[model samples]
Target: MKLFNFHTHNKSENYGIINIYPEENILFGKKYSCGLHPWHYSENYETALSQIELLAKEEKIIAVGETGFDPKSPVNIDMQSKIFVKHIEISEKYNLPLIIHCVKHYNELVKIKSQLKPENIWILHGFNGKIDIAKKLVEQGLYFSLSENILKDIKKADSLLEIIPTDTIFFETDDKDYNIETIYKFVAEKYSMTLSDLVKYIEINLKIMGI
Candidate 1:
């Protein structure tokens, strides 16, 4: 059975979804998601919007983002919010799920979500925060995408795995040079589940989300 990587910057040999660069138009015949990240914000919003609008409709493009607020970024938050709103509109229009990239601006992100009231399923990629914050976000109907960073400390990862809902859990390597199998093994052990079972769970989850 193959692993289902919810968000990866580079294409994987295993069965998983990867992210397509916004500057590129081709889909490359693989499962992927496309969106303009907040850190890459440019003055030319119209150009970015056009590119996203055109590429997001592809059958292979399963989700609508890696876009969201980034408090540490030098780019203006207002600018990031504007682009993020555009992504939400496109995602909702296409009926695709959203893969978010949030930093220290969780509150602002939630505020935008409440205001927009979008229907697309939203998953925050690379989550490595406190369980309290995770609980708050999960309560708000947000999904969590665990990354290799979480594996840096097995005890902490086990603790988080015990708390985060299995149904809401997903995993990814993002841009890291790490093995998804390693992630699966660790998580499966924590949950006392077989690796294949964990892979199947993610597959079912993605299918349910219409990815």
Candidate 2:
């Protein structure tokens, strides 16, 4: 099965993306998760907004984020929520999963989801929460995009993979050096499934996104 990086931040200016000016040549076969990155929001936030909208329309962009609230970041929570809502709307409008970047604000996220009740798929990338917290999000029908940090606690993490409904789970390398192929191999080994089977399962989820 093929592996996918559902939320990569690497974008190049040659691609006409804003805020980020890639310093080096982008690697082959690397699609990305492009967004405003809340920390960089400033007088220039509008620039990122316009470009992101255009990117959302592009078929090459598989997801609408790495975009969401970050409580620890100095950016206003209210503003963050507003921008996030726009992303959620666009993701729904364009039929893309939201590659989320929540930090210290899961409660607010729960509140926001309750209010908006969005239809788009939301994958909380780079997740490292407890089983109860993970269960809570899954119960709300949210998918967690597991990364290396969470994988370190394999016993607890593997238990999550078991409990989360097969379709409601995904894995990522996040920004780590490890690639999705390696992550898939590990997960495939744990699940006693071939790597290709795992890839096919995720490809189905990607098709689910396209639909």
Candidate 3:
């Protein structure tokens, strides 16, 4: 039963899509997802955006982002949306899934999704938002990758796991240093499923993402 991590920041991990900044060098032979994070947006962002598009052509580059809106970021929402749309274009051109990092911008994200109507899968990574928001994103055809928050509040996680369709769910460590198996164990117990069965369902979800 191999554990699959849909997103992670730990580059040492052998199993998962490792998140990389556009300025970082690609570690050959490892699967990665690259983009210019909203928080990292700068004056020379066009250079970084071009780099991401170029990386998108690589076979090991499996996804387009960890890019999305962050209300707290110095970059304005409009600027963030502009960059996000560029990432969406890269995802579509490469026919790869998009790994999103949204912070208090679900409404904007949903609105963008509605406007763009992208065919590539958009996965919201490190989700710990309200259940209603989760349901709303689910309605918009967005998938989710639950992370360390699940370990912090098992009860809330239980409610979320129950509502999220298994086929649209994935487990990840993100930038956390914990074992991904812990998340899988808790979710399996909640759903009354064996670890292997949980893995099988996640595999099916990955297939939907064209992994």
lDDT of 3 by residue, 1-211 (tens): 6899889889987878999987787777778999888889755588998888888875658999899988766788888888889889999998989989999998899999999999999999999999899889989989999986867877788889888888899999888788888999999988899999999999888877778
Ranking by lDDT: 3, 1, 2
Error of 3 at 165 (Å): 0.5
Candidate 1 global TM-score = 0.92
Model 3: residues with Cα > 4 Å off, grouped in runs: none
lDDT of 1 by residue, 47-150 (tens): 87777777766565778878887866557878888888889999999898989999888888889888888898899999987777777788788988998899
Candidate 2 clash pair list: 1-196, 66-99
Backbone clash numbers for all candidates listed: 0, 2, 0
The residue-by-residue lDDT of candidate 2 on 1-211, one tens digit each, is 3356655443432221112221223344445556666665554466666666676676546567777778665668887887778778878777777777888788888888888888888888878877777788887888877766756788986877776665765776555556566666777788888888877777787678662
Scored by lDDT, the top model is: 3
Ten residues in sequence with the least summed lDDT for candidate 3: 36-45
lDDT of each: 0.81, 0.68, 0.87
